[model samples]
Target: MLFSFIQSHDQNHIALRSNDHEITYGALLRQIDDYCARLTDVDVLGLALDNTIEWLLWDLAALKTETVCVPIPPFFTRQQIDHTIARAGITHMLSPAGLQATGQSASPTIPRGTAKITFTSGTTGTPKGVCLPASAMENVAHSIHTMLGNDFAGTHVCVLPLAILLENVAGVYSGLVAGCTIVLPQLGDFDANYSSLHHHLKQNAATSAIMVPELMRALLLQVIKQGPLPDLKFLAIGGSRVDPHLIKQARNLGLPVYEGYGLSECASVVSMNVPGHDRIGTTGSLLPHVQASITDGEIVIHHPGFLGYLGETAPGHHLTGDLGHMDEDGFVHVTGRCKNVLITSMGRNISPEWPESVLLAQPGIYQTIVYGDGDPHLSALIVPTGPHADVSACIASANETLPDYARIKHFRIVAPFTVENECLTGTGRPRRKNILQQYLSPLAVKETPMNFYDQLVAQTAIARAELYRVPQLVDGLQGRISRPTYIAYLTEAYHHVKHTVPFLMAMGSRLPDEKRWLHKAIIEYLDEEEGHEEWILNDIAAAGGDKDAARKAAPNLETQVMVAYNYDYITRKNPVGFLGMVFMLESTSTQIASMGADAVMNGLDLPKSAFTYLFSHGSLDIEHMKFFEKTVNQITDPADQAAIIEVATNTFRLFANLFGAIPHVSEVRDVA
Candidate 1:
């Protein structure tokens, strides 16, 4: 599709616009042709430009010449840019010039420049350049045309800075492939919220525009304000992480929304949700001819034709840092990220994000992060609900009934979470290590045992033990608190939960009889989580609220390790992979709702509203679960049904202990 656009339009229609000036495809082609004629050796040069026509010209030229191009955001400072460029061994630099880095300096040395470097956003430190080949840029253009086909032809506008790979590939290069009129709005001028973006979209009869999560959010906000754009054909939202609620809300608002997966390494697209065949959770099925899979729960792309690295001649397949599953239907659904996986010391593979969502759902916790992979226990960072609210107390309360491992062991109270000013990524995912560096340092610097919260509970348990032991029995409770008792308490709690299981499955949810067996199994194993307070409080109170007695409870994370290579296999990933995940999560939602309700009603005393009070799965994840279903319903891929079953089974195992197992505490402990 894109090839046809390029081949036919040495002249014909408009190709790009920046602010006021409009350039024809013929003219645009001529500029690229000229650049190509000028610098043939500048195969893999760097592309760093704001959302501008010049950037488009260079990008198209690079693609046309088959140069492996490295496109970086204009916002990256000199240090970042230089690090990438030097690593990639790029020979050229292209922009209108004056690209600012924090340290004001420029390498004004080469005409055969445009030094391209595919920098790893860096899992550890010192971001390394993946170093794409100069001529590989065109492969992405080829990939897009092969998948979406050449039918797309209309006005496509720029809503993002041109440097982003998604915006560059789909927004600009794709448009050029279709020979569409490119509309460039004024810099920094967006629709009042998203309404204005929609207005401009309608005004120009925009068929497509590239988007990031933030842009999609702004567009949704605009849709709410100004209503939906009627003519939008494809609104590709990618880059960074995207939430399904946001997608569904946009769909409800009447946007022709579809999502896909791609990486800077893969020329911006690995899979996408087409208009009719869209799936919510899985990135749309692999684009025509692209191959994707989940190998041991990690995403691997096999594009027989992949881009080469910065100036390097070596070639290989692209393996991603993302962890995902391929359903029976073949669509790919990303789960937790492999790079960011938070494995507890107990070997329980927990997606901290899974719990983080629950915490964030609470209005009280503006920002909450759970971290303790490989540590003895889980801990968290919470932005306070309010000035006066005690964060430690909140943490304690939240974890009161939680099993030992998943419970937060320590925490920091950082209020008013701010991503800007370099605390977070442009995409808002925590710079986890950075977060550790900032908050964790305070404890050591103060020269206090970072055991402040730990001691608080310890002291409370001691006091409680004393109270329980009062000889006069002044409303006193008596018992010796010990770790085994807390464990026993957890055990008893689980036992009391027997009837809760069957009742919830029967009373709640919309599952069929055959699938109801899952509910039955869930119910049977649910005793472990019952009467958690008794387990925690019993140990503390037995010691007369003695902190020392409370401290006797040995802490350990849930250590259940099971490698799911069967479903998590990297080779079988297809659209089915996506559908499989969708179905799996839905099944779990049904089970969780049933078990959660039982836990609450049987004896937990939790509020009915707490289930969906925007603080837990009842609140945010319910939407996530739903979107997976909806995405599946939209899919035409035959692999979907099978994918559903595969993902569901995997989901079951991943959460088996957390959901199905019961709690057991051997002793009563003080209120820490």
Candidate 2:
């Protein structure tokens, strides 16, 4: 009932492409079957395998024994490795003579046949191991073949650490199942024999590969250095949402990175972005036999092949902390991580992601992060795409149409983003909190004078801005531990980031359809999200470098709120209010504009590069809100309209009142 797949004949084909070497699936399976026969009595197999071809063989061999395989991440510290080795009762370990992402050397941690413990990463750094039935890994391998096409074995390349589930399945098992060749390169030789890496990619007629965002970024940078790559057919990039701009750039450069969505617990490959089946930003449609739904914005999964957790929290189901929503077409689109969501004291729940993501969507901003949950404001940390370019123009360009609250206030430039170092995890996934603690927060908050945009907001200079609003919760308030004042009264307010939007939509509490229509129209009209950073630059260029001047001219918070209150009155408090009204006008319009202006003043080209982020949403969201108003008003039935107005007005009033009192919360001191 859980965790399984069947074998395919495609297994005789070339399976792996690495280090200028190749091993057919037939050869790979032969080796595995032989090893499995040897390990018939061994239960668990500890794979210390980095990313390589032998790792593939060993993985296959372990599976043939039906043993539960514990693949470790390359980034795990030696201490972590040992903790898991000891805890899991491993009798065997597999590793290369020299640890490497490539497959060239072979050193099974347990000389071939001994039962060994394998460890999976844990939150507390403790290792968890499951008893493996001899056919366990093979069962998983079979399922992989059933999924990726049994057509002549395809060339598979390892992009993530081989230790990751995605790579192990796609790079090893899939190839073995297809009867394809597997490749492995020597250790620590990527740069020196880098051509071998590219050669492996091209020579095996590399048709399939698995990559995390960081690897994609690395490859993208390599292409930027060496012009486009040749022969690569299918590339799966996931572990998180990729920069939309990077996606656009990759396609332009002839590198089609198919985005897939899955987690370690799902046995990987739940949803994949396949050619002709690609949805640029969407994680692509869910695969056959798997069930997925938006539970409070978080992805709840049910799969026929689900694994039993180390300690069975639930049966055949797992709630992945990744936040996402399904499109009307059934495509899965990831918004961000569930834990990544941060709600401020304001009644308004801000998706730092929705806005901050816009920065990465910007052309020159290679990487960008938005932060602020307990703090009074939102801030950004950025990494540039080019060498020594001004960021002001880019920021100014982005702010043109942004609302106030969502606009970035403080900013800092940082190093390029990567997953190789401890900066990123083995799967090429980012540990945002870790990043904040280690690199971002300490430097950004350093006594630097607040930027002009921050100065404007903190001082409440906008027309509708309240100079010193009292927060509903200030003294000793943070985290879910505290009773949420705004959320408590709203009754309908979200309990977790994952559920808020969907929950609101569920009780007939959705953003008005008209607003949705308007948003779609605006996005299409501006061709937004197509190369957002470039869009921002183009918009800023059109605006004539007076981005700050424009902000200075834009209506203040007071003015916008006046507009809102006036609009609210005209509508007689329609309960079916548009989310854009709160999202765009109140938040994006002022804050984004202010941020752009500040960046412009600070001599950065960020404004020009940030246009799509600010203007697209600002313009579209407002239109959406207006459409919502129209939709609410069209109900001539007085009762219905009256009811709608009551809900809208009440929601709006609560929103305003709660937000109005939020500017005064005490800074959160620690993680609760």
Candidate 3:
């Protein structure tokens, strides 16, 4: 039934494409038959194969053998893989290496018609297997075929992993049934890197594709920068709530993105918005085969759906655990997950998704998660549209539309969440528990202690204060500094500041488990230090120097050695010692650099823009020194303390040497 096109039309018609190879309908069916003969004894199989013709062949072979197949997501952790293997009672697994018998047949007991076992995202805990009949998944495909009408027959690119249920059912099965060629590229080719993905889509002349909201945002940015992807006619997006404003933006850019909603238990898609029957924001009306209703704000699906969770009894009805409603025209509008609802300390109930949608719709917001379960007011963790985006203004715009209780009272900008970091689910849902535990406490409180540790750190800083007064540095600064001397100073600063974030990242990564308390501080430091090197380049341009030449310039010997030595110290020796570099730099800035900015500015008669780096560091280091003191004070071990002091003294000596190396430019030479 799946390959009916082989009988009705040309058997040599291409069905699947990967790299430069194409599999025709005749070849695909023959491969499936060959695989079924080899795996006749296997009742249950697991697929850990990448996106390729082999993955599809194995899946079709399992269907022909009436065997239950489990498609394992490549992104799953080892622990999760083990859980799925044991729970699904997988007898064999097909991977890139080849098919191997798992020797794990604990329990094969499932509903009589079980064809595939799909797993949930497992954000909160262990993922539960949803056993679906072959017919149920096929039903979704048929409904999507009918929904799309004549527009269904075209090249469909599988942007999401095949293991994702949305792709498995709506993308693959639907495309196959409609007799459309499906392109399954390696997952890495299309993920995160938007420019490459857009290029691939254009090169392949992709007519339709499936994308998550995050990828859509990236593509939106790409389209805005580049031109439209005219060949890409249909884009089905789901897996998380989509921002309507993002949808609006995409439409304006000529991108054909349609929002839909589904879950594993529903056999992938329950509703979709097609060409004629479209709703801009809401997920379109439920497909013909399924029925849905809002029972006390919870989306309840009435259908003979999944058989049961693995090793568990089946429930009568599937409560999606999602709070949503049906609109006047039968479209399903989802707010957020029921479990994610927050009740304020004053007994004010709020759905974070409602306010979050408003926030994300604002121009600067790229990502946000709202929180206020027992707090006085709502707050959020935000990632802005770009490094220099005005998130505060976005928050202000979002607040104007929200009620007092639901509005964000405060928020902090954080690094973007991604699958590689385990902060986002495979399908782009935030792991709320992980995010809140890692960030909420640190962002909510000022964690610096004020005890003996603080006093000891203060004493250490005081002892190193004289490092700012090296004779060559003091004499050069005390006199009127010339243009060339100032330019040399900036060039060296660029060489070192360019490594600041990378070095901090290395230090943070290498820090021991006992140093867990310092992780938040390190991330905070990363946020501040990420692009300071660019400021130096801007200053060079403002000073009428060749910014391009300065960017390509090599670091002076002293500066290179200082950076190289500290990198070695962090990696080979104690990581805590690297903080000594911070102490040397910030202490010098706080003591002399702040005043030095004005002195050099007046002496050189350069614009204020020329001193962006110096002036920023001057004021910025005052607060940074305070944070550094608190962070260093928390180094309780005597061994750690000694390392910090030794490194600090050595770093000071290096700084003094770097200053001495810069050629003094007298005023007559500078003017000439």
The C-alpha RMSD of each candidate to the native structure, in angstroms, is 21.5, 19.7, 16.9
Q: Best candidate, TM-score-wise?
A: 3
Off by over 4 Å in 1: 1-4, 9-11, 37-44, 62-70, 89-92, 97-116, 123-125, 133-136, 149-152, 186-205, 303-315, 345-347, 353-369, 372-420, 426-429, 440-672
> How high is each candidate's TM-score?
0.54, 0.57, 0.66
lDDT of each residue in 33-124, candidate 3, tens digit only = 89889887787889998898889888988877888999999878787889888888889988888989999883656677899998776685
Better of 1 and 3 by lDDT: 3
- Per-residue CA lDDT of candidate 2, range 381-430, in tens? 77776752334434443443357666666677766555443455444345
TM-score of 3: 0.66
Q: What's the lDDT for residue 382 in model 1? A: 76
In model 3, the Cα lDDT at residue 536 comes to: 92
TM match of model 2 to true structure: 0.57
Report lDDT (CA) for all predictions: 0.52, 0.50, 0.78
Worst 10 residues of 3 by lDDT: 446-455
Clashes of each: 119, 104, 0
Best model per lDDT: 3
